[model samples]
Target: MDIINEILSSNILPYVLLGYAISILVVVIMIVLENRNPLKTISWVLVLLLLPGLGFILYIFFGQNFRKEKIIARKGLRNHHRLNNLAYSQISQLTHGSLGDNETARQPTGIVRLLLNNSSSLVTTGNEVTFLNNGKDKFEALLRELKNARHFIHLEYYIFAEDRIGNEVKKILKEKASRGVEVRLIVDDVGSWELKRSFFEEMRNAGVEVYSFLQVRFPLLTSKVNYRNHRKIVVIDGHIGFIGGYNIADRYKEGDAKTYGIWRDTHIMIQGDAVNSLQSIFLTDWYFVSRTELTDPKYFPASQPVSNKVMQIVPSGPDSDWPAIMMGIFHTITSARDYLYIATPYFLPSESVLFALKTAALSGVDVRIIIPEKSDAFITLLCSRSYIREMLEAGVQIYFYQKGFLHAKTVVADDKISIVGSANMDFRSFEQNFEATAFIYDKGAAQEMKATFFKDQSDSEIILLPEWIDRPYIEKVKESFARLFSPLL
Candidate 1:
């Protein structure tokens, strides 16, 4: 008590307090200068002022704009030189309508040009895309492809658990690597941190080269922790590829034992020229991780177009200069003449996306969105619900999936555009984490995606405006509180 009193009453206390205030002011000034999302900036300011101690720590970890560092810029620009000519030539062809097959392609060719100019996301045709509805089907297909990987296997995932499914996949990777198939894996350091190093070591012993994306060591955890590589990509021999929301974990295959019934998810098994793009994305990340570029002709083997499916494997993140997927979705929504259906686990959309949805709905475009009734995160669920009232007011139909957690990040715009990938319609997906989505411009594929959406819709319960407005005040309070963190979520 005497020591505490002496410290509290010390003559230097005033100087120390002044220094602390100055420091906080300095941080606030930095946040303002960073020019972050206005909402995020305001949230950070409030946190620092209201809870200085905790907020400062949180700011130190997440609020810092790592984009200014230019490492991600370098990573993003690596493909520019190579893709520039291809993009330019394609843009030239696309502008004249020689690139597309039919009038159905006329509408979304704008999106193709946008992606081409923005992200070098080339439009590849004759790619066959098969939707893997759940994790079980995804894995079965993935394993089958893994077994047939004759040349090389490249995989990048946010989560690669050390469970039954992980072991099974690892076993195949080991077997392939042993046969000189050149297997490589990138698991997000933080996402897969639960497993012991030995888990990966076992694969290493079997000759599989494994590395982590944005490895977060003890004290250097900040900054990187906020920007994750959330993409789930698997390229086998540059001919067969897989991309979607399912990470390598048991819960995705078997139902979430702790949460509820089947953990419903969506993935795509792609076979065509699009595989080259998928391969390129994996190699780019692999180069970032291993510093060894795999640009051999074997890595991107020549693939004959398997079908008439036209698509672009769009990639985006902090590494990207522009929010490609977000912008693309905005354009897609605005261009929708008929109806647009979406399925995503998280729906904390950026301002542009939210505006796009509301505007599209208001403009008489039938916009239907399906999200999990009870998401894995309670706070996230409430945060998602907070946007519902505004959406419902705009006449956008919102449905809650009661069967299970619907973790499919998909957007089907009219009969010409079908988007599916690892990206959720959220700030984390658009602004922070690395994501890759295939924007398919095809009638057959779009129709198939619509059919899938309708099937899921049948199982979902729609929210009417009256019922949503009449919800209990306590629930609204929880959602209101959660909404404050939407930008950071």
Candidate 2:
């Protein structure tokens, strides 16, 4: 006790406090030298000045921007070599008038070219797209396909919780593995932190190879924490695939009703050559996670042209040369002739997307966006509300979903294009996380997506400009405060 009192009374406490203050100052200076986006830099600086301890922790986990780093340099090029060839071949064929009699291909050429130039996303002309709305429909389709798996089953998701839905999936995977069908799974380490080691051990025991994406441990959490694989992809026998925003969790796809009503989401099941593109994405990520490059003729079975639906599985992340999905959305908005419709749970748009929406509306294009009235995140909802006034002033119409949470990320323009995927309409989905979007260039598909949007719109409340302008002063101030940290969110 006397020793502890002496230490507390000594000058060591002051020295420790001085050291912490200096550390915070050094981090702020380092952030400035990084030359990140001006808004993000200012946000970090203000956060540090206000709450030094908590801000530093949040920055370490979520704020580090590694856009200039090439972490996966070696195997990435070799893994994507075949897809790159396909992308170039498609570009050449389109350039030389090979698409002689197809008007569907001509309408989306601008966005197609943007994707090809930026990310080598191949435009697959033969695809059968099936849109699945809500959790029940998607899980039913997924389980049916899984039961028919013959050769291999590949699954990846941001969250693989050990819940009712997850256990159901694991049971199917184990049964498949026991029958000599190769089963592999990838789950994000941070997203699936609630999953215990024993759950994975059971899968491994049953011959299901499970690995976590970007293993997060002490001393390496800073670099790996910010970039998450938010993609949810499932490829069965290299012939059928699924991609969308639904994660493998009870809250995502368990039942009909919950604290938030039914989980309204959208996913697509694709059959034909387009599955090869989704397979390519899965193999690339698998190589990164497990380091086992599975490149064989069996992994990509020769697929025949099924339907005339043109589609491209576009992916974007920190490592991309450009934000392919974001740019494609912007181009669609700018090129919309009649109308632009969108549904997203989050509405924190980046500067370019915000500008495109506003400009399109001002130019006489009908722009409508629907967001959930009750969101899972309160702060995010507030930040989203902060942008509604400006959008309304620019003649953009906004709707609030009243039935339940609107967890679907979709966009349909001029009834000519349909986009559905895991990426949100926020900065993180476009700039920070690894995401995927399927661009279907078919009027039929677009009409179906548009119909779903209308059904949800019927269940929503349209917010008028005057009603929004007359919001409570305290609420507006709260949202304004949250808007200051939009980039971080």
Candidate 3:
């Protein structure tokens, strides 16, 4: 009784009560605002209620408006008329009979169509695709193409380290720019944060035009924390283009000086009409980043036949009201006739995606998934493991790549459809973050992608049901806890 009296008499009571009151108030407000999804709202509220101090920090940093409006406003204004009626005409000609139904039809439904319509073009058929497997081959091809530049070169990437590969590429751009090549380079301020201003200064001094995408400045009116341009695109002479799970860094091509051997990644180098789509994407992004009105005829001059590759570029981010890439995935899985193969490093899929894959597998479609045996993020890996049990039980074949981390995001289905891009199969890429992908309807490309997927699968270790069940008790417990926070992951 004396101890209890002393505790009540102490100053801790007031402070504890004050903290409790404030926390409860914030949680209550969050619940009310996010109440439309009762299950999700309750889950988040429980997290906030249980973790106390740290939960508030997580919610503020990650849960709230991570996508700023001013950025959206700028993008909307810059790209307002780009997706007009003329774009539809191009898509109509590109798709032709596939607009209804053909061997390789693109059915971009719902908000995806709206986003496509906004982009001024729907998914076109007949995209010729060349898949570059290693950085050496990729860089060699890029250099060869860039050297042939006649008009302009627009390059954008999330990571552009000033290492060996980057320096070599910079040298080419500088040489071209000095010869009046109209080179425009845009790098993500956050991802390529380490590129010394001096490196850019050299390129600028050599006549290359450069800009940083979404450079977060403090004392800015909007939420200074949200939004990142995580796209990797390169357009050379407005005829050849590249985009995918590749970046401009020595660590990717030939690895860092310390780490030997090349880092395995997939990048697509496309030619023909497809490059125009990439060029449009660059123009819009450049406009938003620099706020400079640019309409140079050389940047997008009247085109003649350069090559014979048919391709469609898919871009997505927060500005749109709908999740564009997610919709594309949903359509692809739903429409799969024979087989569905997915390879991603991260697989924290939304509920709909989880259902689609599971349903596809259960319905006797050969559903297979490949994920890295190890990942860059440990917690996300656990979250991925949490999905394995149910999926395996449903007859979905899960392969853990044993050779090394499988970072490429590719999906090939039944020799008809193929998707390759930087968008990982996760909640963040699907709904929150910026991403781009290419949907290739060419049979030859689909076959090539499928062949490569199987080749990697040979080196993978398929998880057996018994082995999964016999996983250490601690692992099961960890996955359970990790699964709880999946919505927020």
Candidate 4:
């Protein structure tokens, strides 16, 4: 009784009450000010009311910025006029299937169609894709391309770790900068939190234009923590580009993952007109981060004949109201005629995605999903298991990669279309973080991607329904709880 009385007398309750009230007020103001969907607004309101203190904190960090208007404005300025008529004509052809129609070949309805109509891009195609499986292979190709860069090199990634691979790439960038090559690199401050700022500073000192995306600092202030740029792209001389799930970290290399050993991820080296899409994506993001309109004529010169493969680059994030990447996956999976192959490190999908996969499997599609038997995040792995149970019952073959962590995110459908990029099959990537991907419509590329998936499946153990259900009750409970927060995860 004496301790209770002392605690009450200490005035902690009053301070706590004051803080809670402030948070609630802020959350309400942000929701209303941002003009979010009524359904989503109610969902957020429930979170704030239920969790109280923690909910408000999450809202302050993530809820305030749904659309990055200021960032988009800067991006708009960078390439507002370049490639005007021809680009618009291409966009119309890709979207509407005709020069005058406004519908896209991939998505003909909803927000994506609207985005295509408003932001008419040059629907460039004809590119070749090469799968970079191992870190050594990826590093070698990256170095070779960087060394051959003549005009400029634009690079962006979530994590740029400072290990052997990172340092090697860093040294090249430094050397290239010294040679008067216009080098620009952007890294997410939080994703690369472990990477010492000194590494970036060294690059800056060596003449590389470096910028950090949404640097997080302090405890209770700032809303930059939730908005992360998770796009990995490399454009050299505006002639070739690489986009994929890999990052600049030794952790992705063999003998580098001391715990897992073989790190698996997929990257594509694109050649031809499709490079323009990647270039535009970089310019938009660069303008947002650096606040400088980057329109050096040498970088985005003109589209020339490089390859005969058809490809489309898709970029999505919080800036756009529609969940572009997630919707794209859903559309592709639902449209599969014969086979659907998917590889992802994480599988925490939204309700719509879950439905799409199940529908495809039940509709007689030979659906298959490959995921890491063991993951860096145990909670996510467990949640992924829960989804697999449903998919298995729906006739989807689920494989647990026995080799090591499978971080590659590649989707091949019907041996005609393929999609690959940094976006994972999860809620965070689908709706929250910024992501980029490439859609390919080439027989050669699709066949090669399918072959690689089959190779990995040979070493993977298929997950049986009985085996998944027979797991411990405690594990099931954890998954159920994790699933309940799918929207916010």
Best by TM-score: 1
Mind giving the per-residue lDDT tens digits that candidate 1 earns over 92-157? 887676775664255467788899887889878778989999877899999999999898898999
- Location of the lowest summed lDDT over 10 successive residues in candidate 2: 70-79
TM-scores for the candidates: 0.96, 0.94, 0.87, 0.87
**C-alpha lDDT (0 to 100) for residue 36 of candidate 3:** 34
Q: Point out where model 3 deviates above 4 Å.
A: 1-20, 31-43, 66-70, 74-80, 87-121, 219-226, 255-262, 304-310
Which regions of candidate 4 fall more than 4 Å away from where they truly are? 1-52, 63-65, 68-71, 74-88, 94-121, 219-221, 255-257
Model 2 misplaced regions, further than 4 Å: 1-22, 74-77, 99-105, 254-258
lDDT of 1 at 219: 88
lDDT of each: 0.87, 0.88, 0.75, 0.78
Residue pairs in candidate 2 whose N, alpha carbon or C atoms collide under 3 angstroms: none
- In order of lDDT, best first, we have 2, 1, 4, 3
**Residue 176, model 1, lDDT:** 93
Looking at model 1, the pairs that clash are 126-307
TM-score winner between 3 and 4, please give it: 4
Q: Cα RMSDs of all predictions?
A: 1.9, 2.3, 4.4, 4.0
Give per-residue CA lDDT, model 3, range 1-489, as digits (tens): 998687689988888779877977776696577543454566577678788877766666556644334345534443445545545754564445434334324433432354465434345443456898777888898888888887788998889988888888999999999898889999988788898879878988999989887776665413434456778899887667898888888767764334222355688988666777777777878777777756655665455554333445777776655567778788788778799999998888888999999899989999999998777688999999999999999999999987666778899888876888888898778766667788776667889999989988997899998999997999999988887777776
